[model samples]
Target: MASIQFKNVVKKYIQGKQSLQVIHGVNAEIADGEFIVIVGPSGCGKSTLLRMVAGLEEISGGEISIGSRVVNKLEPAERDIAMVFQNYALYPHMSVFDNMAYGLKIAKVPKDEIKARVDKAAGILELGQLLDRKPRQLSGGQRQRVAMGRAIVRQPQVFLFDEPLSNLDAKLRAQTRLEIQKLHRELGITSLFVTHDQVEAMTLAQRMIVMNAGNMEQFGTPEEVYSRPATTFVASFIGSPPMNLLKNAPGGKPGQLLGIRPEHLDIGTEGWSLVVDTVELLGAERLVHARVGDELVIIRTHEDQGAPAIGSTIRAKPREDRQHWYDASTGKRVGP
Candidate 1:
């Protein structure tokens, strides 16, 4: 295992005479054996950053280090890293055992050692029974496991996953996530996973790097990012249903935005008066969508609380302790 470092890493695309910058200066230190997820929306450069670390993309400026050595110019094979792509890149004609052993065989490893390594990886991934099957004979989840097992047998210093769960069904995705957590616990290899799903980032990351428009928005634990976001973008992006950012909220302050989560607002007889617009039933909870002085706000309530009538005037109170303040002009957190 090895620690990775990014120092003012930048990426730019040069076409003819014009240059378009995609990745701004990003700096972070990843500890040895730590699992970090790079998350953002599509076209946000999350995958580009991961590709840079894997030696698959050229760095426009700054440097990347693996362990104590600079790897900015190293070939992908020389970086001692293994990559699992979104698609399961398995050999269709080969059995699982042969597919997993191909890398070691190409490297001229002893035949006996290759067998041992393949066997160990298969055991870890629970693919020992399916080793005799070809790629056509395996299910989607099984094929993905074979891909992971292929990576594991190489014993790389770092693991790079580029939205590896994007193709799996929802149920299989959840199951594979747990398997990955177990794999990391047992092997403890340094890993960097890239995805657009915030839930994946929150659940699988030891620490996460949130990216937006080629710039890193925040880097911290899931708790920190969710509880105290650094900017308005993070506050709105990290949560389900998103936090409400009100410009003309009650107790108005010029050039300031009041931010509050849906769960933090309580429906009551006093406080800000709002007209209910719509309500949604989501199994155990109900979401109240209301308008207050031309601004929309969503409040989360238990199903037992009963949904308010549409167009009915109601009062909802924002929790003083849970309120967030932001600078409307800059979209930045300003006060506690």
Candidate 2:
């Protein structure tokens, strides 16, 4: 295992005489055996950053190091890293054994060692029964496991995963997520995973780097980023159903935005009377969609609790300490 460190890294693509910067100056340290996830919306440069670390993309500036070795100019193969891509890039013609052995063959490892490694990885990934199967014969989740097993068998210094679960069905994705977590726990390899899914970032990462528009928005543990967002974008993006962001509220500065999670809000007797625009009754929870002063807000509550009728006025009460204050102009968090 190896620690990965980025020092003021940047990437820019030049197309048609236009230099579009994809990654701004980013500096972060990912410890050895740590599962660090890079998360953001599409085109936010999370994948670019991961590719840079994997030696797949050229860095425009700054330094990158795997362990103590600077790898900015090293070939992808020379970086001692194994990467699992979004699409399972398995060999359809080769059996799973041959596919796993191919890397060892290229590296010229002893045949016996290669067999032992492949067998161990296959057992860990539960792909032992499908070793003879081709990529086309395996299910989506199985193919994904094969991809992971390929990475594991290599015993590289770092493991890189690029949205490895995006191709699977929702149920399969969740299952595979747990499997990946288990794999990480068992192997304890240094990993850098890139995904646009915040839930995956929150669940898989010991620490995560949240990026936006090529800039590092926040870098911390999942709890810190979720409970104490550094910016309005993070507060709004990280939560399910999103945090209700309201502007022009009393006790806040002019144009300042106040953000509160849906669960933090409650229906109370005395507060802002919002018009119920829509009501969605989920089995366990009810999403009371309402309009408050031209802003659409969603309140999440238990299904057992009665909600205000549609078109009826419901008082929207805010949570005191849970409220997030953001600067009106910059959109960055203003206070604790």
Best by lDDT: 1
Ten contiguous residues with the weakest lDDT in model 2: 247-256
Q: How far off is residue 93 in model 2, in Å?
A: 1.7
TM-scores for every candidate against the unseen true structure: 0.98, 0.97
In candidate 2 the C-alpha lDDT for residue 182 amounts to 96
| Model 2, C-alpha of 147: deviation from truth (Å) | 0.8
Which consecutive 10 residues in model 1 have the weakest lDDT in total? 327-336
Summarize candidate 1's per-residue lDDT along 1-336 as a digit string, tens digits.
Answer: 999999999999999999999999999999999999999999999999999988899999999999998999998999999999999899999999999999999999999999999999999999999999999999899999999999999999999999999999999999999999999999999999999999898899999999999999999999988888888999999999899999999996889889999999999888899999999999999999999989999999998899999999999999988888889999888875
Cα displacement (angstroms), candidate 2, residue 237, comes to 1.0
RMSD of 2: 1.2
Q: Mark the regions of model 2 whose C-alpha exceeds 4 Å error after superposition.
A: none
Tens-place lDDT digits, model 2, residues 163-245: 99999999998999999999999999999999999889999989999999999999999999999999988998898888888
Error of 1 at 81 (Å): 0.5
